[model samples]
Target: MTASAGVLDELDGIRWRERGSCAADPDGGWFEDLRAPAARRARSICAGCPVRRKCLAAALLYGEEFGIWGGLDSDQRHPLDEALRHGEPLGRVVDCALRADRAA
Candidate 1:
């Protein structure tokens, strides 16, 4: 662990909305009304993750968006920007990015 179990403990907060509870969202995701804001908030939650660096690396490799992955998310970091900054490929966390303009 990079810091402590407490880091990831905050990750549970990422699931603010139930998977299939939202009637508006096809996926029934939580915080469907504020997806952009949710991503940022989730990044804050990631700041406490113990394996933040590793998680970020994994996210970068996978291209994970939304939620707190590696102390960041689609709202806090762009896919290409992440790859350029870390000089690595993100095909593991996210296969592709949904929005690049809103990237941090």
Candidate 2:
């Protein structure tokens, strides 16, 4: 299998949601809202999440078209998702997006 496919396969077994900081957030609305303030809050919560990369990978794999994942809104993740769809390594794309998120 290709490296990106393998990465996605590995991601399948991980219980990332159990480890995510958002798991404890009772107000899950922040993640689903497209408003700037809510999106920012969701991203902030994701910024400190241990499973952020996995979350992002899953979002890309599933073609999630809305909300925030891995500290990035749909628009932010679109380019990375496209790169992955175009056969980019999942690890490379995820890591780059995370690094950019950190730098921002």
lDDT tens digits, residues 1-104, model 1?
55335434533443432221221333322223345665455445444444455555444544566544454445555745655566444333232332231254
The lDDT of each candidate is 0.43, 0.81
lDDT of 2 by residue, 15-54 (tens): 7688989889847645566776766677788888989989
The segments of candidate 1 whose C-alpha lies over 4 angstroms from its true place after superposition are 1-41, 79-104
lDDT of 1 at 49: 44
Local lDDT at 51 for model 1:
46
Off by over 4 Å in 2: 1-6
TM-score of each: 0.36, 0.82
Backbone clash total for model 2 is 0
What's each prediction's clash count?
Answer: 15, 0
Give the per-residue Cα lDDT of candidate 2 at 23: 87
Give candidates' CA RMSD values in order: 10.4, 2.2
